[model samples]
Target: MKKIVFLFAFGLAALFAQAQSPAKIGFADVEYIFSQMPEAKQIETELQTLQTQLKKQYDGKVAEFQKKLQEYQAYGNTVPDAVRQNTERELQQLQQNIQKLEQDSQENLQRKQVQLMEPVYTKVGKAIEEVAKANAFTMILTNQVSGLDVVLYADDQSDISDLVLKKMGITPQAATTNPPKK
Candidate 1:
């Protein structure tokens, strides 16, 4: 009985000691980091250029196919039956080619988005580490989205997002979120 009581008392003391220790917490929203970077604008421009290129490719092919169809239709019944059938088959093949082009372009666009963002995310991670160390943070977290459970409320003052972005030489276009004032 004495041993059990002593153990309970010791556990209580340990808990008290832990509660007194410094637990410096910090948080940064990485979405803001990406938005604030100067290179972010450059990336957006590049994405637009890619879209224009894909559009040009698709439109050019479609226009060429339409022109050929018009030429075939103008000849009407004067064209030999076999030759007309062959042209129709070629037109079907052209449609298939367009479908393949669209599918390939979509996949390539996704690939480009990943390629461009991966390095930016890496740089942001390193900047986050540097900011945490410099600020003597015990633990730094990203707005804490835990497996389908998001932390909806965070104190804005606790948000170190701007600091981290600045450290990375980024200028955030938007403001950081602050907890609702009670």
Candidate 2:
């Protein structure tokens, strides 16, 4: 019984030792990858076009609102009490409508961006996965410069941004800059 218990403990230790492979960490800057992707440029152009259209509509509404406000200011005293109140209500409604439209435009732009970016995000994500697996990276971290940077002190040698871009068939520029470790 004692011999069997010892053997069982030894087998568990061996299994644990086999499971404890060293973690090979790698980081990729996805934003850099997106900047190198042509799809991202097209998406930006589409978003800008949508924004211009929304801006035109918004400007038209503002012009209409301003004309109404000016007319109210010019003729308000001469107008009858009921007429004045009605004009005031119309002006208030126009202001509210303008605010609502502005909010809606912002939301529409955000939605469009997400809609356009979803596929690109997926494509880049898959490429990252492939690169990580092919290179035997146990973990991959996002090295976003603008947002929450998860990596604090990664050596540029460990950067997989160029690898990811290459995996996606994008030849990385010779001048791609990787920030030095902090």
Candidate 3:
């Protein structure tokens, strides 16, 4: 009788353990998905054009500053003290302006990129959520930049990137192989 009771308790414990299985996990390469989107190409082109324009403006200012500096150096010894001092001050101001413009250009470019990509990111996020729910995934991870794998090991079958693209109305591409375990 005691043996039978022990066996029953052991069976119940096994059943409970089986019922509490780990949640299903999946991963997606969001950067890959963004690259696949047509809107991303447009954004890239727009950003490139803006960057080129900014570069030209910056170059013009730099050239102007260089010319002024050259002029000052050529005439510094001949010029009166007051004139040399004024030219030096003007050159310093120009240099500061160039630095300010460079900083502003960088900040502007970053702001524009975020503005342009915000909508696409929102759309992709929605698709990921939909795919996760439809496929019963408990959590979804994203691959890091420069091929840095945030997830060391996930089964190949657990990649839901294709499904997410499909949900976003884009055709699914072949899945890349999972990163090797650390």
Candidate 4:
């Protein structure tokens, strides 16, 4: 009975010790880190170029649509029934094509954004992991820059965002080092 009691007390003491140790928690602003990265600028330029091309395509289609519409209106009354019907169908098809292009362009832009950012995200993720491990942080939460409410409040000392930027070889901006006020 004494031996069992001793084992129970030993276990309780161990539990108490473990419970007393505070977890090292830190926060990183991934968005800030990503913004400071050169890859982000490249991605933005590429996306802009793609957006410009898509816009040009959209503008051309609208011009074509407008031209057809004007032509139909100009000679619509003089044209035969069959020609009028065909022109109307063509105009309808062109409208559908324009709408389809708008949708496709939006989707394409989103896909391109994700594709371009995938590598950046991976690189940042690796840097965050390294920083957390090196700093002895048990858990790192996303800073308030993210729309998530995971972290309600965090001390300035607990912010490792600058460390993460340094890990990625980017100099963090001075403003970013300072945590925002509540």
lDDT of 1 by residue, 1-182 (tens): 99999999999999999889997777777766776787778888888899889989999889978988998899989989999999999888888888988998888888888898889989989998898898888888776354222445567666788888788776655664432233
Off by over 4 Å in 2: 1-14, 174-182
Q: Scored by CA lDDT, what does every candidate get? A: 0.80, 0.90, 0.88, 0.88
For model 2 the local lDDT of residue 170 reads 97
Runs in model 4 with CA error above 4 Å? 1-16, 145-152, 176-179
- In TM-score terms, which candidate is top? 2
On lDDT, who's better, 1 or 4?
4
Better of 1 and 3 by TM-score: 3
Model 2, residue 78: C-alpha shift (Å): 1.1
Candidate 1 Cα misplacement greater than 4 A, ranges: 1-26, 133-149, 171-182
Candidate 3: residue 74 lDDT (0-100): 95
Of candidates 4 and 1, the better by TM-score: 4
lDDT of 2 by residue, 1-182 (tens): 99999999999999999789788998888888888999978999999999999999999999999999999999958989999999999999999999999999999999999999999999999999999999999899887657766687888778898999999999987635455366
Please give the lDDT score at residue 73 for candidate 2: 97
Model 2, CA-based lDDT = 0.90
lDDT of 4 by residue, 1-182 (tens): 99999999999999999889999998887777877887988999999999999999999999999999999999958989999999999999999999999999999999999999998989999999999999899999886644655566788888788898888888876563334444
Clashing pairs in 2: none
